[model samples]
Target: MPRVEVAEQPGVGLDGSARPSEDVVVVRPDAVIVLDGATSLRTDLPSGGWYASRLAAAIAERLEEPHPADPADVLAAAIRAVSAENGFVAGHSPSSTVALLRWTETAVDALVLGDSPVIAFGPGGPTVLADDRLAAVPRRGGGGYRTRLRSGAGYGPDHVAALRESGAAMDRLRNREGGFWVAEADPAAAYRARRARWPRAEVHAVLMATDGVSCGVDDYQIFPDWQAVLDLARRHGPRAVLDRVRAAERSDPDGSRWPRPKPHDDQVLVLVEDMALA
Candidate 1:
């Protein structure tokens, strides 16, 4: 059996109040699943963490079933189950980013929705699979669009209205024509997720992470590259990498260095190592 290592940590909100992490990591005999629940801008709906936990549990259960099914189908079924149970409205409820990697002796299968990334390490090096369309949404010319939302900036009615407008604009693009996809109330988005397969022989290790950890590399430019993240996991552990990320965030408490929605978002990581090569 392949050896797997995992780590997770909840992050504080901008006010330094601790909350349950919305990120979830699940490990099976042949797969690793990572999820990042989207923070809801509105207060009337259930928290993103609530939706993520239910979805993650449902997905994990589907994966553990004996019957064989396509990864996309499995995810779709999970979404339907979660939505039915929670009565969540499509395009109006909390959602999550999905990253999954399932492998057999012959090949490795992958699926990615939203920004959570999957990195596969092979003899050729590391290949990173991520969906960046969410970030591609045009931002206002001034910086700190997300930072202002949660930086305790004393938002007035105009500020709140502007943020709501931005969110509505982004919503129109979700899981639609020329728009990015995610595992929300709609299951169709699962079929639209980025999918790939690689020969098992070509893959030596697989790392799945939510945006919290990946932002340290891709967004914050903390590490030199993806390989450095893998090296950090190999030397210390997944939690060590998260620790470094937290340390970096502490250095930039006021978003002057890195303007993000939250000062410290939840972090989750899973590393699957092929024992045959180890």
Candidate 2:
């Protein structure tokens, strides 16, 4: 069995209430699943966190089956069940990113369905499995939000409006041929996940990061590389990395450097280490 360590905290809602992060993590003796739910922009639809919670439970139930299935199959069955339960439509439904890691005595399987990334570490540095299609989507006003944020527009109504606009634009291309894909109401998206496998002996550790925690390594450049991230998490624990991310965001209060949707996002990180003696 792999040893797992995790750290997570929910981001505050617009009302400043303690809202749970849309991100969820499920770990078993041989597997770890991470989900980052999209925040809902519409009141009529269920919140992303709400959807992710039920989806995670469904995934957990499927994983408990006596006969194990492939990682993609697991996600597909869970998505199908949840979408049916909620009467979700393909393009108009709450969604979440998925990162799955499953290991057996002989091999380790990894899959990334969205921005959430799965990194495997062994002798050859670290191998990162990520879906970067979302980043390719254009922002409204030609990336005006980041500019406005850098120019000192805090999380006011204007920023909120920009988010809504960008979200709608992104939604148009979601799960489409050229846009990007996530675990939404479409079970087929699960098959579209990026997948990789490695011999168990080749993997010493694995780390899963939601977009919130990953933005640090991605945009903030806090860690030099994936190795640095793994080192920090292994040494100080995942919460320490979250603290670093939060501190950096605090440093750039107005988001002059890292212009994001919010000052802080839902932070979730999981580190699974091989228990075999070196």
TM-score for each candidate, following the candidate numbering: 0.90, 0.95
Report how far residue 124 has shifted in candidate 1, in Å. 0.7
Worst 10 residues of 1 by lDDT: 150-159
* Poorly placed runs, candidate 1 (over 4 Å): 142-165, 275-278
lDDT for residue 180 in candidate 1, whole number 0-100:
80
Clashing pairs in 1: none
Report backbone clashes per prediction. Answer: 0, 0
lDDT of 2 by residue, 54-120 (tens): 8888887888888779888999999999999889999989999988887777888898999999988
Model 2 alpha-carbon drift over 4 Å, by segment:
14-17, 275-278
Model 2 residue 134 distance off true place after TM-score fit, in angstroms: 0.6
Q: Which candidate has the top score in lDDT?
A: 2
